[model samples]
Target: MSSTCVSPALPDSKTATTDPLPDIAASAPTHASTLDWVGMEDISLPLYLAGQPVLARASAGVSLDAAGARGIHMSRLYGALRELESRELDAARLSGVLEAFLASHEGLSSVAEVRLAGALPLERPALVSEAAGWKRYPFRIAARSEAGAVALELEIEVGYSSTCPCSAALARQAIQEQFDRDFSQSAVDAATVREWLGRAEGIVATPHSQRSEATVTVGLDPLVPTLPLPTLIDRVERALGTALQTAVKRVDEKAFALANGRNLMFCEDAVRRLDDALNADYAPQGYRVHVRHRESLHAHDAVARVERRAPDNR
Candidate 1:
């Protein structure tokens, strides 16, 4: 009688199975809490910026204002980013994306932000040679929107050469000593001096030069029509003319050396020049410039920073 009590055969673990998927995100959270930002980062998306294709590391996020809501529709953000995959990111387009981010979760979020960062490849000509090459400049763009208000930020890193002022002065004094010692008792002739100057011993000592970086951040006023990324980069490079070079021939190297000598700058000089450049532009509401000279002589880098106070500020 006990053996006859077997029930109908049940499904085995080995059997193929498919069932309705769980929807946990829609379920109420165990502890309801508001989050400042909830979304994605380091998302890879292709972008065409300034007519060039860029593989951008894009991030999108939103504030969870509604504490009662279980969670935001994070997948919606991923889908919205697809709309920008093939587009050139501009201030207007970024604002639109932020708008969509908030609109996707009207009750759960009141603010949205998106950031896209990538290196932009630019064709560069040699200092004195006809050959040209490509160089990459890192660029970052961020836009935030809340309750129909929008703020945008643009950042780029510009590299240049900085020569030590004290080192240059010392180098000049050493050269004078070499000149006095070489011809102090001997007679001086134009050809003889030219031959000596062409020698490394004639130069005596060379000033220490370092590769320097300027991290420039600009806050755009709402009235600004375009992103003006190129313009910003141009300003920095123009202000600091001893920019990094790509192609290198003897002529190009000599030209670069000439440029570094002509634009002789310390870390403070570099920062002051960048500050002047930013002030000369009216499109930005505020700006922050950080110049760091990777000291060739010192283990630590020399740094200087400058910022402009925004009228509406932050």
Candidate 2:
């Protein structure tokens, strides 16, 4: 009875509520947008090249913009490249890669770019012997898409021998005269002299043989796709006929010397040969060819660019 009387003294108005107001979170601040490009660089991977799988590394770049965001989704750019990992890096496959990159971002109108630099094996006949070995060279491929159009670029570095026509003729004439005067039955000089004359014998009649490099770029039409890399390489080598090679044997070396003699050329000849090869192969594709030769003779580099004119509709 005492406990009941004490409880009854506490009125309902004096009692406190068991529950408090629910916690509420403030809204996040919105940021202004800007144009941006993001991606991963120098990623190492393995790729199939020249019928063999070899290690390849790549540098990837992507760009996109949003209406209200400051930058693009950087992680997405890397993710796009990751998805392309195991896929072929050919012209067709590259289109898919660019498509995915562009699709990864919502507001981006232009697709990003991917550039891969790696080693490629070139099977070359031994210089002295008929046996063959592989030579590794630096290779690069770049691709990008803009306004629903895609462009692919391929770069390959190859070493080849260039014999001078002018020097060769002069050397031959000098050797003939020396043999006629001496009558010593020694038509050619010692090994050292022969080597020296071989290099010096050219059309230009210079002491030093010209060491040259060729860089060619062709603009491809989307409608006519596919890049015939191997074919192009073969055509180029055929045009020059003196491709530099490693692992040479005596027989192969002799053969190479003959080839060099057969295809002696100047810097201008080399550039023209490249142009002819490209024009013949890409005639239907409608591509413009650009050729540059780093000449050893002149201080300045020699460059030649040619574009096929548009077909007449009439």
Candidate 3:
């Protein structure tokens, strides 16, 4: 006993300090009131969608429904988000993330939601030529869970060409007048007229065509096997008939022009077309269609919105 002296800071065998790390989040709130949702945003993550890898901006949130809990576990929401990186970004897979978020905050949360936003480069071919190129479409997927029910939403941006129907008809009227004026003085032979039709002056006017956009958002039906993202894109492009071309040669440009000439639509027409197509498709439980036609003749864009509701299979 005379050889050793212990520091006062050292604990005796009977008394000892346990864990010292403080968990402020687990403490009770000073003022008691529940919050709707709280978590993180603009998180970076990778997604494998439709067999393609894409970088996405991710966000996750969970409701603070428990009035007694000070705060929900934010770290748990971030941890659950990691699951998206390992699986194909789809309805079934993303639903797991939503479930995990609520499960991790079991006592504090009853609702959870996550959003993944990114640009998907979709390869499309020229309308009339063999050339092809890539177009980046802004895409988003949202998953939400309340109580025990889960819902998934898929959103995509599609660019295409829209020519005015009235403009085309007016241009045709002017051409007919031009034909009458030109042939009034000259002999009307089939060869001469055909040769004139091939010339620049023969086709004096062309209806204006401008780039248009369709923002299609659909709620997926649980019965669908996989995410039909590719098919959704294909359906929109096919419905519009004048999808924005990637590569453009002289031949391709001509083909695109032909396509626009064939598929003339106003903003009203676009929403109706997309509305019908989505309603007819079996993969979606419901859908919302929004289209904007950047008018060539006017400075403002013409817009339309349509919603179609289907049976809630969920």
Candidate 4:
């Protein structure tokens, strides 16, 4: 054989322009898709918190791995998020950013995700005082893309008071028995018994108390985008009726105590109430939700979760 021999079919003009189907295949080549997780993290940015322009920061994370890509286009992930920072990041703005992330990595058809978390302040309206200020709440915002679908989740932490119903009833019974015994003695008066029992150790015995918290996740409709964080917080606080306050006066403390007694709830009670509230507010419009309560009595925590089916996936 000669050292430089040409192939016989090298100049076959008959089959020069093979089938056009290979170029039109709407999928990646076999060896370009195999990354596990990719995206951004701890990227600081600003946010308009609770209707106020606040300099808030967040950790933005994303992943772009398809069925067979070796790795994601790392540069493209940053570029996509840069577009988000250039534009304001509202709920609507965040959804658009997710779309941009998917479009940036063409072969990444399966794994696409974004996460943002920051502390947001809530503007309080002075429930029991004259001076009005803001309350800061920790919020976590996350988004994910898979199979042409995207979702957003919000986690909010709120503080509230909870009184035990069982304790309250027992206290009332003890007070009644004291009055009856004082009447039988004919020397000690009912008022004296009340004064003695009103001491700290006497009146408030074994009162089960907890600072309740609620965590909710919602799937947003791209067509109609809005962050429901403020609305959700208000609903949760009202339902529980004993939220902890940053600024308080004597009058405020009294009102808060009254509220706690009126809305006494166990951990189970709080979860059920929150589940009902979320279903009524968000389920009909296509949103998923979950709630958790941190117990004060037991060492371990109590959690509750609920979800509404999406329109297409139902």
The predicted structure with the larger TM-score, 2 or 4, is: 4
Stretch of 10 with least lDDT, candidate 4: 20-29
What is the per-residue lDDT of model 1 for residues 1-314, given as tens digits with 9 covering 90 to 100? 35556688878868759696887766788888988998999999998877789999999999988877778898999888888878676777777778789889888899898989999888888877797998888999888888789988889998899999899999999999999998999898899999999999899799999999999999887546677877788889999989998878999998888898899898889999988878866434788899999999999999999888676664
Candidate 2 local lDDT, 1-314, one digit each (tens): 35543444554655855566532311122654444556777887676655555577777666645444444555666666665456444676667767887887656436578777787777766755558888676567777887787777666655567776777777777766654555455565587455644553322232235445555555445443454555566677777777767777777877877877788777678777777777765554444444454556678765565566434311
Q: Write the per-residue lDDT of candidate 3 for residues 1-314, one digit (tens) a residue.
A: 36887766767757876777788888888878999889899999988887788999998999897777788778888888888885676677778788888779888888999988998877888766788898888888888889687777889999999999999999988888889899887678789989988988988888888899999999876435787788899999999988888788998888877888889999899888888787766434788899999988999999999877656543
Question: Which residue pairs in model 1 clash with each other?
Answer: none
lDDT, candidate 4, at 173 = 81
What's the TM-score of each model vs. the native? 0.90, 0.70, 0.89, 0.74
* Model 3 stretches with alpha carbons more than 4 Å out: 1-19, 282-284, 311-314
* Candidate 3 C-alpha error for residue 133, in Å: 1.2
Off by over 4 Å in 4: 1-33, 53-69, 86-88, 108-111, 187-206, 285-314
Give Cα distance to truth, residue 32, candidate 1, Å.
Answer: 2.3
Q: Rate the local accuracy (lDDT) of all candidates.
A: 0.87, 0.62, 0.85, 0.65
Error of 1 at 90 (Å): 1.0
Top lDDT: which candidate number?
A: 1
Model 2 scores worst on lDDT over the 10 consecutive residues at 22-31
Which is better, 1 or 3, measured by lDDT?
1
Candidate 4 accuracy as lDDT: 0.65
Write candidate 4's Cα lDDT for 164-205 as tens digits.
677677777876665565466567667776686776544544
Tell me the deviation in Å of residue 63 in model 4: 5.6
